[model samples]
Target chain A: MEKMPKWADVILIPAISILLAAIISGLVLLATGKDPLNALAIMFDGAVGSSRAWGYTLYYATNFIFTGLAVAVAFHARMFNIGGEGQALLGGVGVAVACLYIPWPHWTLALLGAIVLSGIFGAFWAAIPAFLQAKRGSHIVITTIMFNFIAYSLINHLLVNVMKPAGVMEPATASFPEAAHLPNFHDILGLVGIDFAMDAPANIAFFVALLACWFLWALIWRTRIGYQIRQFGESESAARYAGVSPTKIIMISMILSGMFAGMMSINNVMGEAERLVLNSAEGAGFIGIAVALMGRNHPVGIVLAAILFGFLYQGGTQLSIQAQIPKEMVVVIQSLVILFTGALDHMVRSPVERIFLALRRKEA
Target chain B: MDFLLLLDTSVLGTTIRMATPLLLACLAGLFSERAGIFDIGLEGKMLLSAFLAAAVAYTSGNVWIGLLAGIAGSLMLSGIHGLASITFRGNQLISGVAINFFASGITVVAAQSWFGQGGRTPQISGAARFDPIIWPGALTRIRDLLQANLSTKIYSQIISGHAIIVYIALLAVPLAWWILYRTRFGLRLRAVGENPAAVDTAGISVIRLRFGAIMIAGVLCGIAGAYMSTALQAGFVREMSAGRGYIALAALIFAKWRPWQALGATLLFGYLQALALRPDIIEKAIGVKVQVQLLDALPYILTVVILAGFVGKAIPPRAGGEPYVKER
Candidate 1:
């Protein structure tokens, strides 16, 4: 067998896999007694048709972006940190505690403090498993999964008792102060001459998330730590022989990965809602894994992959309401992405890359 | 103190019941893993079996048949995983995860379409549920001494009071141990996991043995799920198995993959879970001061701590993840 070019092997296979997935999904729609085109149009409209719909879609993307980055960060070190859900959940606890207990004279500083504290708490949550893996040689996947369950119980306990709002029956903590709420650009625009129907709870966090993605892309592709992490991923023993402590690298990689997930809590606590509710982050952490895998664990690839998922999530909800298709189809789609992406190798990558290259050549 | 006495009974009962499913799952993991197949999809298999078993019990009004159906369903699912991983040489972890997702979607669709229910199946009648198998009139005295206020059926449902199934599950420990340590078949299975090429050279078919082990794991997981939904609760809810199957895998590792050791490890986890769920015990023991939810977190906390400490020396099968291809 001939060895394919390195770049082609990495890039093209996943692209073809996505195309094949799209075709398979279309076939699935046919089998499910639905018109593929109509369903697609409805999904697109729901995700990005109007200004209000577009705002919601963008807001959804913001959370995905951070989570995708979290998964990507760990992937760079050849570590599959499936514990993004736990890290994100624990981070939300930090943000919730800050909003409820931290006394700040100004809303902006308080909100900023809460977000920063979220990163610290998330890093701490991840540190436990990282320490186990680094010091004791425990597998991160199983340990991280165990931590996710622990976080679930711990968060549930805190919400129902210590952090809960007084006189509220719901198992949720107190709402954030008005000053701590995220600033929605469209909401701000409505006050001026621009009269667009933008959704409530939409915010500028999406832009921040987009910028963060670009920054991550630069970090991985340009920086020294990025190279070291990638080198470690390629071969831990070789990297160790080259003087990098496997323990330190694993610890730092997990902490950095956790910080990305922690930022996702901000989108939920500050942007999506004002209070910390039970399972509010909802499997975004797991979905982030799918996104990372679909993106081939590349920073830019993860960003694009996150957006695609965001579209599906935003669109699926709308389609369920309008087209009468089940909203849970989004979950199915997510699963399909993981299923196909998990299996592919050189077979899927080459043809897609050659096609893209041909298109670029024509454009040039 | 009155509270402390109540807490003691609650703890004992909770431990016995909780340990039931965990023990079964740990045993299932031991079967497949010892034979050289990584069975991460135990979670999915258990969930599929739980849903099917409950739905069938409610529909047919025969809990025994439902139990059989659950085991059959899980075995079929596990067979598919075995084919994919063992026969096709696919990645075990990914295949297991796919099975989990597929099981979830299939269960939800089947539940909604067949029973016309949303996420939960119709609750089975008392006649259709697994009642306790009491050992005649004299055994009733032991129940009182143990403060087992619940019916003998409930005790046997998940624990000792179970029909032939409970005894069989316990019996499986030594049986699996014999297969792993005493038999040439066991040697081949372990060799397949450690190094398949060597096993191939020894003229033993690694593929066939791994497939057999995988099937055994699946059947055991199915029975465990059936025990939960039909025997224990007489109903099934969405994601009812939760992640206990994976936890069972953890237990197997914690026990160092020894069948007898797995039983002890599984019992510890099962007890922790029971202690967390029984609120009556918590209130009595701690003077109603602490939150019950905190207790629920105990099992997971202990799992992380135990695995980190004890699993440090766990040496996974050498060729565990590598897809075996015959040298052409």
Candidate 2:
């Protein structure tokens, strides 16, 4: 077996995978009787043609970043935590409870409280499955999938019965206090006299997401515990031989993963919607899986992959409105990306490695 | 008498209706998992089949055609899974996940573009949908033969007047049991799941066997999806399968990968679903306002408990979720 160069492994493989995904997505567009080239133009124009589009793209990216980091952190420990959806939903509940119940004097204070509560709530939801996996040998993937449904039902009940204010028919919490509202991108840019989109939901939470990426990078690569997690993921027996407890690594990594997933509510629930609503996660948790896979589980890679998906989401919305193309086209594209990058990786890798090997032999 | 009244024909009938898809899907999962492949994409295959089935049934006005189309659609997805997991030797779970997302997205995209009814097909009727098969004078004959009573009526109704697919689903259990436990193919299938290396050494192609199992699961899921759209409902709705695929997976686990037990588990889950639909009856009987959400979440909760070993342990196939790699 020939080993490919590092650059080929990191950059070349993903580039080819994306090209493959794009080709399939174009074929899908053609099958639907839409012009593939025209659809591409529409997506490009919608995603980055204007500052407002950038605003929406970055806002969506913020959610993906948090969830992506959550998944990447767990992936480092070889745990597939598919419960990010449920964890994020519970995090929204946490944000809602904190914002609606607590009379914070300022947005900064409120944001801090929301962050802590959301993280704790998300971690709490993940802890059960993690405990089951760590102590009882339950499959984390199945347990996490089950937890997602349970969280949905739980949130539905809470929004309908417990949180709905009197006289409101909607299944959502009442608006947060005015002070609890975080400053949007427009307001933040106004501090430096830069004009920006006023209606865009991009807010201070986007910066928080970036900060989370840095935090995760340090936690996963720099810390001693991170080494243990990586070791455990590589081989459980080897980790056990090296005096690293598999149980501890699984619990810590999962809890951290849940915390990141939960913190996503700060961007969507607090900064964007200003109230807790049903289905607030809106498939971002699943999108995180694609992001982590395409990015190869690196913090920087996750940020870039998240932005790409964020573009797809925002652009897909535009295409739906303008060209009558279903927004689900984005989902098809995302699935193709996941398939090519995560599942059929070797389909591209083996060929690419062979090419690299031939190139090296010719040079020699 | 009160207890008997609570367990009336209506309740039992709904239970069977709800359990039909579940039973089919559980059997599908059983076949795949028993062959060492974890197919979390059952929901996706079922969803895609449901959409294709409804769309074709409405257009051609033939339920059987729709059923065939649904099966073909599911097999297509199963082929993709095989390409990724068996041929490419990729992560089986990731392949399943991708297939699920692909099905979910493609179904809605196609439905919305083709029918333009907010991701649903036109309501199918007449011969396009499977109508209930009522045995002539079944109710009267049972009453006359056994003396008129509620119990006899319940028994008669439970035994007759369901969609033909329901009977097929019921018969499939015994068939699946015989195929799994009584045949050489079944032995090879089970053996491959347990230890592919051993199977490989014994001159069997592990890849071919796994692909066979995946295809079988695909066909079963197709029937289940067709039953949902063509037999149970009039047409397709977006995400109509909902989480039934996951619930079926749970039922498969609860049954510990056995055929007869899969039937019992699915029936129990279907009963819970039926009871949830009639919360008023539950409230009256139990004298407590049982939250419907609790009922909706019960299967998941119970599966978690079972997975945690609070109940009898569920040990999966040793080689499940792993792509077999032949040593060079």
Candidate 3:
């Protein structure tokens, strides 16, 4: 088999796939009687037009980063953690409990406490499916999907019966204490004699996501457990030959994946909403898969992919508001991107590899 | 315990009504999974069909024409899935996910564009929808129980007064079973899922067989979608399928991909849904208050328990989710 040049494999393949998806999307817009170029301009303006726009984009990107890293971690162990939706929902439970109940005098202290609680909650939720996959021969895919529905009901139940303020009809818990509110980028920048976007939800969690990317890089490449996980993902038979226990690797990797998914609540629930609302996690859990796949399941790659998707999401909303394109059309475009970059990846790669191989053969 | 009191004819009737979509969707899933294809896009296909069915039924004022339109709409998605996963040899799961997103987005946008009613078609009613076919009282009676009492009526009414699609959904199980076990095509279909390479080696067109199976799935999903719009509801709502496809897939897994078992699993899940729908009646019958959220979550909880091997192992077809590539 011919190998693609490193640059093509790392950069060019995704660029062309995305460009193809964009061209097709443009055709779709034109078919619908919309101006594609004007739509693109509006999206660009909405996503990066001002610091406030960047704040919104970065806020969305932060949620994607956590979930994307969650997906990337599991992909290392050859596991698909579709349960991130469920895990993230459960993590909100953890954050809500900590914020609403804890008598912390400071937001920083509350953030630390919430982080540990959310991680534990998410990990515990993931462990059940992990146990089923390892010990009971259940396909992780079906179980995780089932768990997502279960999570929604569970959270709704809690909000309605257990957490809702008395006489409140809506399915939402009380807002967090003022001390529990996470400091946004504006606040942090203000401390350092700088200015930033006001009233924006792009909070300290963005920095946390950057830290997570670096942490994921070190964990997957530098640690012994990471080596074991990669080995197990690459080949179960070969890993067994290397004396690695499949059960241990599966459980640890999935728990870690769930933890990252759980930590996303810090960005969404803790930073953005400041309340544990129904549907807070949204579809970021599912979007994480595309992010991981497009990034080739690497931390750096996932951050980049997450930001790109963030741009799409923010920009797509602008198209709806400004250009009269349906917001759902963005979903169509995003799915097309996923279709090309993730599913039909070889469509771009194989052709590029062939050309590279032909040129090398001619040179030889 | 007054468990028997909870099993009222009304509950059973609701169960039958709710089970129609599940039974149809799972049967659809059974065909796709049995043909070495992993179809998680059943929800999307059903949603698309539901919209088209309602839209056409409203326009044409004929339920049958709407049904055909629904089937055609669903088949279009199935064809796309078949083309991507089989012809393109792409990742089956990714294709399935993409199909789901594509169907969801397309349906809403198209519905909003065409109807301009905020992503819904006009409400269809009476003859435009599937009205219940009530059997004659005398025909539903036993020879000795001709007395028109409540008990006799309960016994007979359970089998009567349902939309035609409900009966079709019930009849589909036996028909699917016969077509699966008692036919030559069924044998080849099962063989292809287990070992497509072996089927390919025998000079059979694996692509055609798989494509045919997926199309059969599309038809079933179309009926399922049509049932939702024309029989259960007046018109299509956005996301009317609402994860029933995923639930049906879980039911399919619990059924171990067998037709009869699929019927039983779907009915069980449907009964759980029915119980959730009538929480007041259930609480009164049982003389105990039940958590509505827990009731809503019960089927999923049962699915997880079953998937955890508490019940037994549910094995998938060996070649399922693997795109069959022709060897050079």
Candidate 4:
């Protein structure tokens, strides 16, 4: 029996949790000798006061959406794929290789090829840990954490020794060919006769992120494999008894998760930077965990959560620039949100459930 | 001769110094995990304490006060974890992740506000930091030390000069073993991790035991953080824990959660880190250019291999990662 209505479970609890997080963030600001109200006003203005702000906000959102879906998919199988950071790093390598090495006639074809290679690269990274977990009983959490470090080291080696263009001091690859350039929001919006910020990195990749969210929704709710994955998540022994292969579910879910995380490079690496840079993932992989948790692991919820985080990211930059407040203040807020929604959920949940139960009793 | 030089006292000293934090953090993990609580937030706790320790030590000019401040900071974070995971029966892993993010962010934010040195405390020196302790007669010329014997050289070079915390970390291993095996509290703690329901039926308070374990972890992590900032580096740098907490976790698994084995595993990892720091020696010895990243990634890779059972199985506590429910 559900102790709370669906609406309350889906909306009310998250709202309250976010409110608590905000309150705590305010306290942190005050403790640091900053005015909470002034900070909030600045953040609000920088996040949504202008169309250009929306452009930056949406660009950041696009990255979070892809990574969040990656986390959400693995989470459906009750697997914690924290290596989204590492997987996305490898995905950037894939995008770099495809765009830099392949001579593409047009941007559209290059995009397709980059997507495929990135997915392959990300899935390949994820598969090893999945295999270890399936066959050797290694904990996925620990293995994935290790893989993140390995991926970082690999990327560092490649950037410094292998990938840097000749005579370039920075440890990043040369720019991709102009033919592979992705149309930014300015160009994409111009196609429909809509004026947009010229310099904002938001691009067609945003639509691709939306498409992924929709596709994941269908995959999780409309496909047989999704059912099997969720079943395995619910009870491994029960799923085994129902003739579902635990190994198959673990492998498929993790690969799909990796693919989504890898594809995130499309937005950040190809669309925004137009080159592969070190630490290009920019902590979005970890943000995806917070997104997935806050979104309740649902597609629509993830999109909403991703945008909220995007606002935080954009606003945080503005805060650092304009108010002289360190940008990591946003990280403190994000952590509190994760704590309230993900870890201390019952602290809010049980009390809400009791209130609902009492209301029902009063009605009776 | 080159290979023999690799085993010299200076290298051994470096290895011991490098392994101190790992040993402390690994034992911290041991206490927490043994009591049915899986703590991935050791990194955050250590980072927070490292920052606070240095900050306080700089202000107060007392290393002991800084150590206490560090412990207090770690304890505060541990309390939050206990509230989320133990009292509220929430997800332990998520709580850990949150604590890590919180520590990483708050330290930088606070450091910028207080010191304004781009997320680092002022470089501490003299009275504010833990200086290396040199034993009597060890500082004398090698020629005067017992006819310059290798044993005398080893004693003077390898064992005599280290921060006092290094000795504490080494002593902690035997102390951990004794507390975990010889004491009644240790038996109950292990039992709770294996079967919390059984422990509950035996009239032991599972919540209190888990909280006790977590508190102990906080104290050890506090010391580890202090060692890093005040003893090892002389100040706190942003993200200075530098994944040692994770490496310590890997060491915990590599040791199969045993105290003595943990010492061996941490020393091995420490040796690898020391080797990575001296790439010139490695390149000269092997006649090959070995990337430092390779050695940096070796411990994680080795842990993965161990976890995969190629080396041996690393089975965690039977009831680890679960919030004990009276009903379930």
* Stretches of model 2 off by over 4 angstroms after superposition: B1-6, B140-148, B309-311
| Model 4 chain B poorest ten-residue lDDT run | B139-148
By descending TM-score, how would the candidates be arranged? 4, 2, 3, 1
Each prediction's TM-score versus the true structure:
0.87, 0.96, 0.94, 0.97
Selected candidate, larger TM-score, 3 vs 4: 4
Question: List-wise, what DockQ does each model earn?
Answer: 0.37, 0.73, 0.60, 0.74
Best candidate (score: TM-score): 4
Instruction: Write down the worst ten-residue block by lDDT for model 4 chain A.
Output: A322-331
Over A261-334, each residue of candidate 1 has an lDDT whose tens digit, in order, gives 87788887767777899987787887787788877777677777887888888888887678656555666567
Model-by-model lDDT, in order? 0.76, 0.90, 0.87, 0.91
Interface RMSD of each: 2.8, 1.2, 1.8, 1.3
True contacts kept of each: 0.33, 0.76, 0.65, 0.77
Residue-level lDDT of model 3, residues B1-328, one tens digit each, is: 4677568766787788989999999999999999999998898889989999999999999989999999999999899889778877887777777778777877777777778787888999977799877776623434544556666557555677789999999999999999989999999999999999899999999999999999999999999999999998999988788788988998898899999999999998888878888877878877888887788888778777766655486788999998998899
Model 2: per-residue Cα lDDT over B237-260, one tens digit each: 987987888889888888899999
Q: Model 3 over residues A103-126: C-alpha lDDT tens digits?
A: 999998999999999989988889
Error of 3 at A10 (Å): 2.2
In candidate 3, position A14 carries an lDDT of: 85
Residue A6, model 2: Cα distance from true site in angstroms:
1.7
Candidate number with the higher lDDT (1 or 4) = 4
- Which parts of model 4 are misplaced by more than 4 Å? B139-149, B309-311
